[model samples]
Every structure is written in structure tokens, then in C-alpha cells.
Target: MLHYSRTCGTFTGMKANGTDVRPWLAALVIGVTGIAFGACDRRGADDEQVAAVEVAASWRSIAEGVRGDRIRRDAEMLADDAMAGREAGTEGFDLAASFVAERFAALGLAPLSDGSYLQEVELFWTRLLPESARITLQAGDTEIDLTIREDFVRSGGFGPGEERVDAEVVFAGHGIAAPEYEHDDFAGIDPAGVILVVLSGAPPHFETDLRAYYSSSTVKQTEAASRGALGLLVVRTPVDQRRRPWDRYLPGVGRTDMEWVDSGGVPFGGYPELAGSAVLSQGAAERLFELAGRDLSELFVHHGAGETGSFPLGVSAVLERSSDQGRTVSANVVGILAGDDPRLRDEYVVYTAHLDHLGTLDDGDDQIHNGFYDNAVGVATLLEVARAMTKLPVPPRRSILFVALTAEEKGLLGSSFFAQNPPVPIERIVANLNIDMPFLGFPIGDVEAFGVEHSTLRSSVEKAAHAAGIVLSPDSMPERVRFVRSDQFSFVQRGIPALNLKPGSISTDDSFDGPAMLADFLDNHYHRSSDAGDQPFSESGAERFARTALLTGLWVASDKDRPSWNEGDFFGEKFATGRVAPVSAP
Candidate 1:
């Protein structure tokens, strides 16, 4: 029996619970299970090192085996041309479901819920058309009238009931409220019902990462609703700057660049630094700003930021007025691998990866963003994990489930639905190990355990990594916002610990080849057609990744106790200090 003890909330369990039982026992299990699995090789390495050469040596072969044979096979099939763009609620998303279902069948994986694998998610499509959008910003006698689409792109204004609505535009400088910063955009102004025209993104007026403030359509939606406005019209500011141009794109959960998302090729999502707010052509934006007696820089710096004020944007629009608003139904694929241990099996370990991306583009490029690297790799590796485990020396003690969510790119819709209305009671879940863009390059060194800051799941990740001789990436990338960016956030919201593991990164301030390689992509292939190609396979990296994950699954699967959050982390506090999970206010 394994002996275990907990110190500072960290659990320690050796093959014999730290006793000399291991000395007399023959090394049979180590040879068969530990050594063959890379368990011995990666025992200890400094934080500064990348490849746990000795550690990697332990599991390289099996990890590579899982990657090359199993993971690659599944990836190829799922990313096949037949799946189309796999847009949420589309025929393609459904087709991909069958493909995944069939793969599960082939792998001999069992159903997770009531012996049935499918979990239907209901989705609604809202299309909007702009009947009227007349906004004129005037300085004295000069009035500038702006039309829609040609001058700006408006997805129908979200408001209660109305055949049509229009409100005068008011320049409500940054619509933000941060008490710590002593800033208040709505301090003295109340532009209710009218269109609240605020500058999109932060300007020089703010300190801190600008991308965190206004990088998505959500902030606009959130603020508009919060301020009790009829609609929100965001004015673009030239103040935005990023390391690269495409950095402006919100690699939002399932979002892709070329209309459709191809998961197989993309790298991890860094916050879009470039200007992501709606870009109104130069001429049109200037005309509107001129009315406020502000030029590009001044308005962006002083008048831009935040989502408050009673300014009406004089904005009216609809969603599907264009040909692109077609609708379809998609699903959330759920599969289960039953645990052999009755008690542990009742406690579930959740696995999730987004399966939707930008469908297709207009330039006659019918190619789907198969999302191979973006998430297909995560999903594929997950499938491979299921395969390896089901063939385990003995079935795991806990249940392992697979979920491929839809519309992650469209604001994490499917996962949100799951989080909101879980098929099983949410509390029964132990932890969620989410997979996303796994193949930027095999982690030559340590894996980036993204939410390592959040939960005890991080400890499981690190221990498994250490057993394999790999170190966890050095620190939390608060700027990277890994917690809020992935579907893991949803699970975290419900009090289940979530772990997001990066394939692994090398040490040296960064990986030796990482920076140059990323610069190359950001400059050239980041979102171009060049990303999709049949390149020579390097088994070393893939094996390292799978083996590490295999160990994590095994560790989490074997233990009777479910993983929890570390006490100090934000998510941990929410659960421990407050028995009830916190949610968006009513």
C-alpha cells in the first residue's frame, strides 16, 4: 500500500509511502511501470533548464509512441477535409461529432452519462439589420453624418424590444471605473438611453495592460448593459500598439484568423496587442471625432477608455443582414471512460477542448480552419490518453470524461452552457484538465502549466512532470491571462480545480529556439496559409507531452481524493472563504 502524508496542503505519496518497503521489493514495477513510462529519468532538474534530458529519457519512447501512433492518427482524421469549417451549430460541427464518436467507439472508450455519449446543447442565432444609423458629430456649424458598414460595422445594437431605436452620440471619455486608479468615466455624466460612444480600448489615460481592458466585443456588450444604455458604439483609437499587427486579433477561445479556425497549426494565444476594436476607416472616424473638438491622439488619450455614461451612439444595425448570418445546430461531444474503482469512479475528472473555429473565408479559400493545432491536438491527445488508460494494467480508480465544446471562438458559448447547466451535478467533478493548441513545438524543456497559480491541480501537474524529470514553467504570466482566456474559467467558476498545461517550454528566460521561432510565425505564418503543411514529425516533443499527461491522468485517476485549489489563489479563495460559488450578479 502507498503511504501518504500531507504537509502545507501538499500530498506526498511514494510507492511505499516514504518507507523502506521499496528497498526489499524488486524493481519490477519500476521497470514495467515507472522506468518504461519515463518516471525515473526526470526525478530532479533545476528551474532554469528546459528539456529534462535525463527526465525526458525516462518517458520519451512511450510519450512519443502515444503521440506518433495514436495522437497523430486521431488528429489527422479529425482535421480531415470532410469536417468542413466545424463552425458552431453548423453541419460541419455535427459531422465532426460523429467522427469523434466513431473514434471513441474505435478506441473502446465507454459512455460517460447514462451509457449515452451525446450531450445536446441548445443554441439560438440572432440576426440583426440596421434600419437607421444617423450620427452627426458637429463642432459649431460643421455636422458630420455617418452611415453604416461603409463607415462602420455594427452588429445589431442589443437592447430590449423595439422595431428601431436611435440615440444621439455622446463622447463619454473612457467608460471605466477602477477605484484603485481613482478613475471614473461616468463620474459626472449620465448619457442614458442615448448611444454611449466610448473610445474602444485604453488610451494613454490608463496604466496597466491595455489589452486586458477593451480587447473584445464582450467589454462593449458588458458595459453597454451595465450602463443601462440602449446601445454602445465604440470609437477606435490609434493609441493601440502591439508587438505585431495580427496581435490585434483576439485569439478568443475558439477564434481563428482566416474566417475558419484550423486547430492543427496555431500556437498559444497571446492577448491581441494590435487594435482589435472595430476599425472605422480613417476618414469616417476623424469625422466623428471632429465633432467633439478632439483629434485622434487627444480623444484616444483623454476621451477614450471605460464603458459608462449616458451617450447614445446613434447606432442601429442587424446581425444577419449580410449573407454570412446563416445558422445551423452543433453539439457538445461528451464521452466517458468508467473507472474500475467504485468510489473513485463516482468522482469525475473532466477533460475539455474547444472544437469550433472561424469557418471559412471570403477569398474563395474554402479550406476549413480544421483547428488541428489550435485544439485538435488537445482533443487528439485526449483521445490518445483515453486509449492508453483503458489499456492500463488496471482501470483507473476515477472516471475520465471527454468534452469537445463549440463556439469557443464566439465567446465560449458551448462551454458556458455546460458550466451553466452541467449534465451531472457540478460538485461531483474533481478537476478539469483542459487541452488547447498543444503543438507549437514539442516542449524541449518544461511544460507551461498555465493555471498553475490556481489550484492543487498544479501540484499534480508538477509532481507528474517531476516524476518524468520535467520542471513546470518558471512563473505565472499574469499578462497572458490564461485563466480567463480558456474554457477552464467556466469550470473554475463552479469551484472545480482546472489545469491548463502548455506542451512545455524550455528555460533560458525562454526556450532557446522559442523567441526566434515565434517571431518568425508572428511575422509570416501566424495566420497565413503556410501554417497548414505536412512537415516531418519529431516524436521527441509529442512523446514528452503525452507521457507527462499520461502520468497526470494516472496520478489524478489513482487517488481517491479529488484535486482542489491552492489556498491563496483567487479561485481557491472563492471556494474556501465562501461555500457558495460566486457568479455574475443578477
Candidate 2:
């Protein structure tokens, strides 16, 4: 497995196998795994002016120093020239990997496998012909036919051979069976032997907060799989550009593959139809909704995705699609750090961040969507921690793993891959602290952990953040379904308690001056081009941010027991026992 140790201020690769892989690491050399939190907080007199972490000076100073020349150098090297748009398998991305490997080498990190730093992820890019879709409706002699692309899209779902069918349609409104909302879209339908037609996402026409109900693919995909249907179709009215559908197929782009998992085992029909998740056109969707006595013309206002609510419609439609689809291989970078206490070291603590981002957009723009803010920063943090942890006073009691994942943007693919294909046993991992956009400094408040309140890590988080003087952000907007959107979601799906750490929304007390800065940051750079160094960052601020990350990681790393998931998440039922696999020492 990949290995990392801090020497000086960076990580270097090392190996210490045959050491207790579980139950508190035994041979953890004390000085080898020391950590340094917030150097700005150092009380000594000889330290340089922390730059006060104030205005641009403060932000720039800390950012530059902590990030050091390496960050800038690596950013340039890892990021493509024109952003080569690092699409998987593209020569440009291979170059990008080379750059990361070089940095890992310079940082003292070692390849988990042999001498080669390249993880070599494999995948298939099946760019479909614009004409890959075909659908027709037969309500009467009207015989209405829909156009492709604009009207409807045929996302390749069938694997290998073509998946074409001529069957009656069923309108499963919302395609949801959420007992929490007291709604069952498939209340009285047998989707078997028929093509199940349902709306793909939450209804844009709904009159309430549609964020929760419509944000995740689980509604359309999971519920659809439960019912025995030959195929499934999601009625499409509009698409979210920020959330593209094609990112699912790229290498190191969707999910990591090292964990123990059954790829695609998540049957799509939470209902009972073994169908693929594809979007259906509005006109074609209307034909099926008409069966339920709903009027499309009455609700759809072409003025702009139209004003609608986020509710599920029980209308169904007829669908037919076929394509030559295939499976691909991706990897999650995994490495083990041995701890001192032989008994405690075996308990594992997994630190993860998805390395994949929206690869090349190819709208023919001269720039690449390098995903600088989306998560390259998080990956960088993982690298930094690897270095810091190596400097620990000695190996801690528990083993720490640094996992650079793929496909997290594509529904936590890399993490999911590892969950099913773990290098060790799944039961060994005790807790997971996942990072995303760590550098996107939050408002002056405690860490706003998405799922912490629902897991065993809640108290631990509060204690740790308090020690660091971090104000915990409450679940003020729980309806956003923030818990299900990141890489930690995969571990949570496996019943492992995990937490996603981020700065408070934004604060006025600090450099950026709080609320306004936070808002602009989120709306503008959270996933955009400006997230790069273009937005000034103080070296002190960077240090504070890095320190908080470094400190929190230490707290978690020292824990003896695995964290537990709370009782409320949708995926909680998967784990009958409330524990994840314990960690092991290298």
C-alpha cells in the first residue's frame, strides 16, 4: 500500500509491513509521527510576524508559507497549461498524474505498490452519437414523436449489447417510497414486465424546498431498482449544468476501486424494474403523465426552466433506449501509517478526499475545468497531513490512512469502489474524516460538519473543534441534503461514521470580513476558476486553515473506538451493527 511520513515539513514514502495491521499499531516510532498545528499560534518570541492573518497581507503570508513554493509549483505542474482539461486517459491527464507523483516523491511519500507512483486507473469513454436515443409515443392517431438531445437524451445504460424494449409504461410519481414524507410513488404498481417511466429529478414545478427531495440520484435510481421492472426511465424536464451526467464514465473520475465493493450492485430499481437510469423528454413524458390526468402545457413555462416546485409527480411514460455500454476500472490511493501501541494501532482511521474533478469540459473553451477549488485543495491537504503525521512524537495508537479517491464528484465512486474492494477488512476502519475544499476558508465559526450530529463522532467533533476554538456550525439548512453529496457519503453508506469538515459559512471578524466573503466565495469560486490563487490567501490564514485540519486529524487519529452513524440518515439501515472496521498499523 502507499505510505507517507513527514520529514522536515513534508511527507516522504516509507514502508513498515508485517507490523500489526490492526488493534492499535505496535511499532509506531514516536518522533516519526509528530504533528504541528497552527504555527501562527506559536507563543515564542523569535517567530516571524504572523502577518496577523488580517487583510491581504495576513492571508497571503500564511497561504504562501504553509503552501510553500511547492503548492504553487505543483499547482502549475499538476494543473494543465491550458488546463489540458485533464480528462481521464487523455495524455494531458497522464502528465498531470506525473506531476502529482513528482510532488509525492519530493514530499517524501512512497508509492503504496512498487516503485512506480502512478496508480494507473482504467476506464472506458463511451461518447455516444447524438443520435444514440430513440423513443416514440402512441396515445392515439396523433402519434407524437420527440427529438433527441434537446427534447430527450439517451444516456447509455445497457451494458455491452443493446437494451431495446417495446412495453407498456407505468407512471410512478416521484418514484419515491420515502415513509418520512408519507408518500409512496409506487404505492400500487407492479413494474415487472413493463418499462417503468418516472421523472428523473425532483419536479422543478414543486412549490416548496425541492433541494432535499430532488438533489440525489437515489430517489430515481434506488426506488426504481426495488420494483421489478425490466427497465427504468426518468422523465426529463431540465438538466443541471453544474451537475453533468457524463462525468460518471471517466477514469479516476467517478469512484475509487481499491476498497471492497460490488460495482453496480446497487440495483437501480428500488421499485422492481432492472432498468438503467436515463432521462426522458418532456413531450414523451407528457404522454405518460397524461395517463394520470396531468397537463404538461399547464405547468411547463418555457420562460426559463419555469417556476416549479421540487415534488415528485406520479406520472409515467413509455421509453426505449439501447447502447453499447461497458464497465471500467478506477483506483483509490491507499496507504497505511503504523502507530506505537500494538493493540490500539490496529484500529483504523480513514482520511479521505476525492481526487477526481470535472475533467475537460471540451465546450471548446481554451481553459480546462481544473477543479482547483472543488477538491484539488483537499488532495493537497491530504499530502500535507501525510507529512505532518510523520513528524508526530511517535506513531499514535491507531493507524492512519491517506486515501486519494476518484469519482467522488460522480456520486462518490472511488470511495464506493474501496468500500467494496478494501485492501484490508471493512470491519477494520473505525472512523472517516473526509475533506473537500479545505482551503475554502469558512466564516469565523466552529467546523460545520454535515453528518456529525447524526453519528458517534458528533461529541468528538465538538470537543476537538472546541480545543481548536472552532465554532461549530449548526444544521441550519438540513434540507440541503449536504450529507449525501460528498465522498464521506460512501463510507456512511457502509455504516461507517464519517464527518466532512469545512470552515463556518463565513465571518466578518476575519480577513475576508465574514458573511459577504463567504457568500461570494460559495456562489462564485466554490467550484469555479477563481478558486485558484487569484483570490488572495494569507500565508497565516493558510496556516490557520492547515493547522485546524492538522489538529482535527490528530484528534481523530488518537481515538480508540470507531465512530458510529446516527439513526436518521437514509442509509443507516444498511449497517445492522453500528461499527466500522477498526484500523491497522503498517
Candidate 3:
């Protein structure tokens, strides 16, 4: 009695076609005959039939209940001016937490903490005092002063109080010591008690995997510290400056940096060996090289060609820096939906999304960075999924924990804290599904799942996507290393199977340019005040994404077997213990 149509390469059905209707009619007739014949002796059969009906009804309700309007409304509420960007450790973030908690309570989900919905995270906040910062380069008879926030920016991760260092400068190529790759920058050089100057990234000609791993600032700093370096001066090349302009770093010049406090209530000692570190602007770096009678561009050319050498620049530098430190409290909002099977109910499947964004900026008239697409939409998707789960007729086999993590913008600190100190046993958490920023500007045909290649959960995600009439795609931007950048990485580091989802480039309509749209957002709106609530968005895409996520979580939670990392997977073999022996890589 209903019609169907195909529009823009997508199918829409109002009623079953003749081929589909015949099977349903036959099944109904068979069911009716069985019920009539067995009613006198099969009382349990009636109960089974009623339960089956309830299950079907519940599925229909969920499929219809997840609507676009609701998702948009929730996103607008979270991204409104009243939330003030929802930055962690501020009143705005507190308000956002309260809203999430209230929604959880209304949905009839239980609190994860002991009689509370919040997991309080104690953190140390530190900010550099630029006025008290000083740096000078002395080459022969000339002394040049570098201005803070203009020529150089002080790096975080140092303890409170001032540190003054006066040491000779040594140029260390790439500043990496990778024994695995038979590479060591400090092969014959003793950088003891000196200021080690290094380039920003690895050798341009190195293999991609090795380059990415060694190019991390953390690895470089640890290497420099091990070599007994007193301080680090990272010189920015012209290419680096072009990639990230100096103006982009100005907003964070005096902004607070946060790190989680350990269980013993002591401040976490992070990279304690390095006394001071700073990033030099391109101009400052050129001037330093000019003093040494060398061209900065030539050094870059040599490094790009995989040249490795160390030299004394005949320059001595002194750096004096101070920081203001304090402690603050932020919370991860957690709620739980209990499962059905008594034995499996203790195990958990976590759904995580960050609830924080970049706060107000001081330089612009429009200061509040309303992160509507960056994360408000993600949280909205999470809430809608939770609502749908609450309406299910039968609960999953494993418990579901919905967590809105805080301080994710601050290096996934909140998720890290939770993973280290969980409300439930760490080993009992089976899997994690993290939603960070889902692009909802247009309808997408495929979904990208980061970290899918590392675990058996790929099978589960594929099944869910098939059920939703959607296709699964691998991470399109592996160069971004997105898997290790989000909250899911914290769970992965704890040896749990996790994946982050987003819409992929492939779309249902020719009018939608998904890749270009994504690039535009990253270039123009990401972490900017322009990412406000008023921006145009596609609620249909958001609703579809939420549905896919909900189905994926359901499949994982209901399965009898626990999800595990595939044998010989890089993350599994490195992080997990007491597991199967790793097989040879294919």
C-alpha cells in the first residue's frame, strides 16, 4: 500500500516490495498455525512469542526514535554562547557536565561512581610567566636577546620556579636515538651540560613509520635528557613556520597547561631532566645561524638528505624562565546501563567522547570558540545513542559505560586518569568506542574506523555497518596518526580494543564534496571562533552516524566472546601482557 523511491543513489522504502512481502506473509502464516496448534500444551511458547514481539517493537521504536531534530537541538544547546566553549576547569565546563548528568538521570541510567555521576580528576595547572622569561644568545662579542612570543615560545612540562641555564650550544641532528633502526644522534658527541639545538622533525628521507615515531617531541626530549643536556632549543625552519605560523601559537602563550596528579597526591613529574625548553621562530633561528657563519637553509637541505652530524656553533646561550602553578578539579561524567547475563554483566564496554574545547581567545572580538562540529556534535551523538539503548527491550550481555571525558584537548588527560584508575576492574573492560568529531555537513556513504586494523572488533563493526546499510572504510588520513591522538588511545595503551569513527569521503550525492568540506573545516574553523552554533550542518548525517555507533556498541556488548587484539598487532604485542604469542606479520 506504500511507495518506494531511489534518490541520489540512496534507497528509501515505504513498504516491502513483492519479493520481500511474500517471505513475511509466509512466515506470519506459519507462526499463526503453530500458535493455534500448540496453545493448549505450550504455555512457555506464548511467553516466547510475546517476548519476540516486544523485541521487534523495541527495534522499531529505536529506529524511529533517533531523529535529526533531537540531535541538532542537543548540539545547539551544548555549542551555545552560554556554554562559553566548554573549556575544562572552568564554570562553562561544569555547566556542560551538569547538563550531561541531568540527561543521564532522566534516561534512567545509573551513576558509575559511588552514588555520584562524576569521576573527579585532580590536575595541576601551570602557565609560563612571560615577563619573567629571558633568553640571550652570545656569539663572540655580540649578544642578541630573543623576545618571548615573538622570536621564541617557552615550552611546558617543567616544575614551578625559575631555571637559569648558561651552556654552550651544540647542534644535534634530529635529536633521535633509535637503537632499533641503528640510528643514534649522540653516537660520538657528548652533549653533557650544554644546550642541545635540534630540528623540528625527523630526516625527510627516512621511512614513514620510523620518521613518525622518532619525530615525536616526547621522544626527542627524552633522548636529549638522557644525553645530559641542560636545555633544548628547537629551531623552526622556513617550512615549519609556513605549516604553523607564529601567530597561531600566540593564543597559547600564557594559557594554562594541565597534567593529572598521581594516586599519591603528588604532582606528576613530567620530563624532569630538562631544565628549560623553547621553540625558536624562523627569524630567530636564521639570526643564530648567521652568527655562526652558516646558512639555516643549507642545514635543512643536508638534514633532508639524511645527513647526520654535530657541530659547535661557537655560541653560548642563557635562558631564565618561571611558571605559576596551581591545582584544579575537573570531572568525567559517567553513567552505566546494566547488562542481562549475570556472569557477563560485570564486564564493561565503554563509549567515550570529549566534552571540552578550546576556550575564549583574547585577541579577537569574537572570543568564544564554540566547538559545534569539533565536539558538540560528538557529545550529541553519544547522548542520542544512550537514549536509544535505554529503550531496548533486552539489555546487552556486557554492561555499557557512557563516559564524557574531560580535558581531552589537554592531551587526553582525563581518559588517561580514568583508564589508570577505573571504577571497575581494568581487565573487565572488553572494548572502547570513542567518538571525537564527526563531520555532519553532508550525508556520507562510508564510515572510517580508526584502529580497526589492530583488533578483532573489526568484524563486529563491519556487521553493524552492514545492518545499517552503510559501508566500512579504513582510515583515509593515516598520516594524521588519528588513532593515537584521541581518547581511545588511552584505552588502547591499557591493552583494550578500541576504535574511533567518522564519516568518510565517499558520499551518496554528487553535490557533496566530503573531502573538500573536511579540509575547509580543518583549515578555517578548527579551534577557531568561526566554529560556532550558527554554522550549517546536516542533522540527517548526524542521526545516521549515531545509529551506526549504537548498533556497533550493541553488537560488541551482546557477543558472547570478548573482543581481543589480533595476533601480532603492533599495539597488542607492545602493550598487552599474558596474551597469546604474536604471530609473524603478514
What lDDT does the true structure give each of the candidates? 0.53, 0.51, 0.76
Q: By the lDDT metric, which is better: model 1 or model 3? A: 3
Winner on TM-score between 1 and 3 is 3
**Candidate 1 similarity to native, TM-score:** 0.72
**Most TM-score-accurate candidate:** 3
TM-score, each model?
Answer: 0.72, 0.71, 0.84
lDDT of 1 by residue, 1-586 (tens): 1111112111123333543422112112232234233323334322222222332233333433465556666666666656655667667777777877777777677765566566665443433344343344445466556555456544322222123444455556655655545656666666555555666554344432233434444555555556665555565555433332322332221122211111342211211121112335446766665555456565554454533443333333221122113323566777778777865676678788887655553323434566566666667777776666666545667778778877776667667667666777777677788876665453344567666665666656776655444556643344444555678766876777777776543522232364444445435543333334242223455555666677676667656466766766555665445433422111
Rank list by TM-score: 3, 1, 2
- In model 2, state the lDDT of residue 372: 61
- List, residue by residue over 315-355, the lDDT tens digit for candidate 3: 99999878887789999999999998888888899999999
RMSD (Cα, Å) for all candidates, in order, is 9.5, 10.6, 7.9
